[model samples]
Target: MKAMRDVWGQALVDQGAKDPRIVVLDGDLANSTKVDKFAKAHPERFFQMGIAEQNMVGVAAGLASIGQVPWTSTFAVFLTHRAADQIRMLVAQTGANVKLAGSYSGLLIGAVGKTHLDVQDIAIMRAMPDMTVLAPGDNTELLAMMEWANAYDGPVYLRLARDPVPDIFGADYTFEVGKVRVLREGAGVALVTTGTQLSRVVEAADLLATAGLNPTLVHVPSIKPLDADGLRAAVGGHDLVVTVEEHSVLGGLGGLVAETLTATGPAARIERIGLADTWGESADNAYMLNKHGLSPERIRDRVLTVANQVLASHVG
Candidate 1:
């Protein structure tokens, strides 16, 4: 298991080495976001912008306008909430080639209190017109997505988790923009998820299989530019389609799925598992996840209940 933040930091350093056009800006969170490694490796290219997130984003936009690939790093809450206006006007509107790295995303950063937690970032970022929102499931996927973002020409938001998560992909894993990855094949139900919540959803799938549920597992790494046809093909025939994420059920993965499926045509019954439009509180990781119904056991139980209900309705 490896932390995605660590991989992201190292990837930035490696990318900087390859391309002199790459520069890094941090909102006084280099150590927390793991961008200090990049600062250490490339001092001249790194800019410490203190706690001013809006200014940092503006600087990044300016750098991008001058043919520099600028990557700005900060806490997800700070980046999304504090610098939202700048991001919308300078980066997204102008189509600046800026990469925004939002670390400590989701409900896991409870130790730092609710102020530091950011569960609505996906919704906010994906809502922007030209912003590319990405959430990687593991370290390998993060590295691949970072490389892709570096090469892509637009505003990109990379949502990263806090702690070390189990690896879901191998070293051979490659990330493509707007492609959904199918991890397991089964029947009746489709278990869909994104970001660090995937590992737990995998465990929940195993538990459901033991109980004869046998759901097909799908991972969505790119929230924006979602693979609509691929998603429809993956979950169309299933009786129950469940979308689980470490974000709020509203306007995140669940909302994206609903928007996509509803626009295309008729769709299967959809269920969303995540924070129910509530703010995060101070607590440990395990407790917070359980409280928010994101734990593997909790996910399994909820899915099983809904699956049984669907089965009964069909039988009746």
Candidate 2:
């Protein structure tokens, strides 16, 4: 399995070399964000903006104004919160073609503590107009999203995890924006997931299948500008719909799927499995995930419980 850093860095290098207008701006974390690969290949197209995320955003906005596709790199916490004002005023307000690559999103930055963790970024960015938020589940999806964002015209935010996740899509898989991938198909229940949480969903689906229940698995990579039609179709007539995410349940994939299903007028029960609205300190990603009931076992239990509830509701 390829790491997210490899996919992100390689995509930047590939796109930067192809398009002369594509430029990279690093907030002194190019090495972590994996933009160093691009810097090495095309020095003139890469700019080091030190540790000032605000200045880096403004610089990217300026470059965007001049018809350059500026991809900014930094930790998710700093990129979304520390430079929020600049992102709002410059990128969202102006509708510039700026790409924001926020690496180490969620509690994936182990041992960095709450100060570095970015759990609220989805809620913040989703509220901003003209911002397309994306969280790829694995390396193949990340590569496809990077290609899409480079050609996409407008403000875009790509959230990537540092640690390697299991590969879900095949090498020949193609990704479309605002479209979800269904790995497993079932009728009793459906699992809607985004980011690294998808790996757990896959495992949970297997367990559910072994228990004589087939659970549908949906992978929603794009958080903002959700694919409501596709979601409704995938979840149509299902007894229960469960949303899983590695981020907060309030405004992440869980909330988005819930809203869409409700609007679609589905009588199916909606369940969310994700991080609560709380901060996390320095700890292992796996431990943090398990603490918040994000593990495959937790997901399986929740889905089974919801499935039971759905049957009860129907029987009544």
* C-alpha local distance difference test of each model: 0.93, 0.86
* Model 2: per-residue Cα lDDT over 250-292, one tens digit each: 8877778877877745457788887778877788877887788
Q: Return the clash pairs for model 1, or none.
A: none
Model 1 lDDT per residue over 117-223, tens place: 89999999999998999999999999899899989999999999988999889989989999999999988999999999999999999999888888999999999
Candidate 2 deviant stretches above 4 angstroms: none
lDDT of 2 at 175: 75
The root-mean-square deviation over C-alpha atoms between each candidate and the true structure, in angstroms, is 0.8, 1.4
| Predicted model with the maximum lDDT | 1
Point out the worst 10-residue segment of candidate 1 by lDDT: 259-268
Q: Which pairs of residues have clashing backbones in candidate 2?
A: none
Whole-model lDDT for model 2 versus the true structure? 0.86
Give the number of the best model, judged by TM-score.
1
Off by over 4 Å in 1: none
Cα miss at 147, model 2 (Å)?
A: 1.2
